[model samples]
Target: MNLLHANDQAGAYPPSYYAATRTPLAEFPALQGQIQADVCIVGGGYTGLSAALHLAEKGYDVVLLEAHKLAFGASGRNGGQVGSGQRQDQDWIEKALGREVAHKLWDLAEESKALVKNLIQNHQIPVTFHPGIAHACWTDVQVRDSHVYAEKLHRDYGYTHLETLDRVAIQNLIGSKVYKGGEIDRDAGHLHPLNYALGLAAAAAKAGTRLHERSEVIRIDHGATPVVHTATGKVVAKQLILACNGYLGNLAPNVAAKVMPINNFILATEPLGDRAKDILSQPIAVADTKFVVNYWRLSEDNRLLFGGGESYGYRFPDIIKTTSKPMLEVYPQLKGTKIDYAWGGTLAITMNRMPCFTRPYPNTLSASGYSGHGVAMATLAGKILAEATAAQSERFDLMASLPQQRFPGGAALRWPLLVLAMTWYGMRDRLGI
Candidate 1:
């Protein structure tokens, strides 16, 4: 079964807390006839919308296609933490590609966060973008490493926003004894992901991006000029962008080989009132060092938005119980808290846990496999794609030069291989090794 249509209805958004709270947006018409544009973008999430807005601002005629509604996938449903740095730690990048390239990558990451803030301000998006993200540690080794990494960021990268917190400090901040230690990055923050996505769509539309909802891309024919086809229409463009991420099924075999999709679940508790403050004294999001990281923050209405479960298969598990079981472990006091909403979304991951930027064909480009740190990186990617299409490609080439390792097996057997690998890591997490 196609993962895109597996959990959600065609052209419908998932019943996520994000959707329930999102600001309403007028729906766009689906593509029903042949269309032409300078740039044809697939998938209308953060990446596609950002690209459309940036390109449209540059006077490029752009057409963006979404199989479902705007912000319907992971872009809208994820933990809204605008994280710091690249998905992999800077030390890892330094080790793999040396210091010079690592520094460039770090600069790009800093630009990513700044761009998000600028968009929210310039476009006047109504999303509540707050400050602080606490990275909690469960084991003492993790605690030691967390501090070491924090120090490296300061010494090596000149980043000074992170403050290390001891066990007592973390407990006081998060109201949880499970955390041994952690660090809070004041620069990184959280927001209402869906509203932010919708705001981007509105900005793109105003900038003259022709957006078509419910227009799923069935195939892409590459040449000097490419044709993107839907069931009822097609778009002929000089350049094509594949920004589908997890929802990119068999449409592009080259991308599917490297970027594998996985399902994650999130649940929101009923308005916790004063109880919410007791859980998180500071209004910062918290993500622990679990193999399946437990990320959570508070809603504007004082509800606890928690996300923790993972599924290798296409189907979602008992969303409430699976996520609540781990959540209760973190904050057992919330054992009886009413779960107001629960939802799941699919996101793509590369073998090296970094983004996969590929030039699959001469005129076709693709960006995906952001792992879990897509909120900022994906947005940056769209701008980079737009710049590259306009013949300015220094930054895009830097990212594409990063190694993108594919899964060991081919498309047919990759899922089974990933299951075995992720199973071993998950077990190690439980064993605290």
Candidate 2:
């Protein structure tokens, strides 16, 4: 089953809290007949929209095609934490890619966070970025490791936004007795993801990008000049960008080999009112140390937007049942709270947990496998893609240079292999080992 349609209807966003509260963008017409452009971007999520916007701003004719609505996939459905660093921590990057490259990646990550803020400010996107992301640790060892990592970031990278939190401090802040200790990154923040995506779409369109919704890409003819075909129409362009992320399917066999798609679920509670303070004393986001991380934050209306649970299949599991168990574990007092909305989204991940950026063909570029840290990075990726298209390829090449490996098994068997590995990790999380 195509993940895009396996769990959702055609041309409709999931019934997520984000979709319920989105800042609406008027629908673009589906692609018809044939069109020509300088760049043809597949997938209208953050990467595609950002690339279109940046390219259009640089006087390049762009066409962006979306299978459903813009931001209709993980981009709109995810927990909105604009996290610090790449999906892997600085220590991991340093160990694997050396300190020099790690430092450059760190700087790029910093720029990504800034880019998101600047886009919101410059575009006047109707979203508020409340700062702070608390890392709630369940074990003392984990807490100590986190503190050390925070120090490493400060000493080596000159990052100073982290504040260590003791057990009492964390319990007081999160109103949860389970966490032993953790740290808070004051620079990291959260926002309404769907609204931000819609705002980007609006900006891209205003910058002269031709966007087509419900125009799913069916085939691509790759060469010096690439042709992307949809059911209703085709796009002939000087360059092609594959920004499909979790919904990429078999469109590009090489990218599909290294990037695997997994499903994650989230649930939003009814407005907590005064009880909001009981869950989070401050307006910030929190992600715990679980292998399948539990992330949450308060909505502007005071609702708890909690995300957890994972499945490897194309179809989503019972979202409320799968997510609420973990939600209640963190906040047992919320056991009886009304769940206002529940949804699931697919996000892609690479073997080493870093994003996969590559030139599958000389004239074709593809970026996906953001792991869980796509919000800011995906936005930056758009600008980099635009830069590459403009023959200013330093940044894009730097990202593509990161080492990547295919899943242990090929596409046909990767799913089973991942399920086995995730099951083992989930067991470790349960055993608290």
Candidate 3:
């Protein structure tokens, strides 16, 4: 089954809270006839939109095609936590690749956050960006390790935005007794993901990108001039960028091997009014130390936007029951709270959890497998892709150097292997191993 049309309707956005609250923009027409451009981007998510906007600013003709509306995929349907560092922490990167490379990666990560804020401010995007993300811990071992990492970041990295929180302090801040301890990164923040993505689309169009909605790429004839075939039209360009992330099916087999798609679910509670303060004393986003993480934050309308559920298959589970189970575990007081909305989204992941930035062929580059830290990283990747196209390759080369392993089992068996591995990890998470 085609995952692009698996759960959602064709040419429509999911019935998500983001869709309801987002400021709507005029939709672009579907591709028809033939088109040519300096660059043809196959996906219209953050990475594609970013590249489109940046390449347009550099005076390159850009064409961006989306299967649905702009930001209709994971770009609009994420936890919205703009995290710091790579998906794998700096320490892990340091162990895998040396300290020098790790430091370079850290600098690039910081640049990603700055690029996002600059875009929002410069373009006047209505998405309200906030600061502070608390990493809640379940065990004393996890708590102590977090404290040590905070100090290392400050001392070694010259970063001092993180504050270590004891158990009592964490409870006071989050209004939850489940957490043993935690640390808050004042540098990290959250925002309405869908609005932010739409803002990028508007900005890219204004900068001269020809964006076509409902223009799904059926295949790409890769060569000196790659021809991207949509249902009704085709785009032949000097360079091609594959930024589909989770929705990237078998279009590019080389990328599909390294990046596996997985589904995650979320739900939003009805307006909590004064009770919202009881769940989160502060307005920061909270993510706990679980293999399958539980992330949540209060929406601007005072609703608890909680995300936690797992599905290896293309389909999502029953929305309410699948998500509510984890939300109640964190805030049992919300047992009877009504869920106003629920949705599911797919994201790409690699074996090492670092993003997969690779050039599958000449004049063709693909950036995906961000895992869950796509908010900042994916947006920044667009800039890197644009730069590489413009013949500036420093930043893009640094990211492409990171290791990304292919799935052990090929096409037929990859999905089964991933399901088995995830089940084992989920069991360990429940056993607190």
lDDT of each: 0.92, 0.93, 0.92
TM-score of each: 0.99, 0.99, 0.99
Q: Which ten residues in a row have the lowest lDDT in candidate 2?
A: 309-318
RMSD over all Cα atoms, model 1:
0.8
After TM-score superposition, what is the CA distance of residue 184 in candidate 1 from its true location, in Å? 0.3
Q: Residue 213, candidate 3: how far off, in angstroms?
A: 0.3
Poorest 10 consecutive residues by lDDT, candidate 1: 309-318
Q: Report the error of model 2 at residue 53, Å.
A: 0.7
Candidate 2 wrong stretches, greater than 4 Å: none
lDDT digits (tens) for residues 1-433 of candidate 3? 6789889999888888999999889999999989899999989899999999999999999999999999989999998999999999988989999999999999999999998999999999989888999999999999999999999999999999999999999999888888899899999999999999999999999999999999998988989999999999999899999999988898888888999888888899899999989888989999999888999999999999999966668788897898898888889999898888999988889989999888898889889999999999999999999999999999889889887789998989989999999899989888888
Q: Write the per-residue lDDT of candidate 2 for residues 1-433, one digit (tens) a residue.
A: 6888889989998988899999868999999999999999999989999999999999999999999999998899999999999999988898899999999999999999999999999988898888999999999999999999999999999999999999999999999999999999999999999899999999999999999999999999989999999999999999999999988887998898889889999999999999999999999999999998999999999999999976656788888999999999999999889999999999999999898999998689889999999999999999999999899999899999998998987867888989999999998989998
**CA displacement after TM-score superposition, residue 282 of candidate 3 (Å):** 1.0
Q: Give the TM-score of candidate 1.
A: 0.99
Tens digit of per-residue lDDT, candidate 1, span 54-125: 999999999999998987889999999999999999989999999999999999999999999999999999
Candidate 2, residue 142: Cα displacement in angstroms equals 0.6
- Screening candidate 1 with a backbone cut-off below 3 angstroms (N, C-alpha, C), the clashing residue pairs are none
- The count of residue-pair clashes in candidate 1 stands at 0
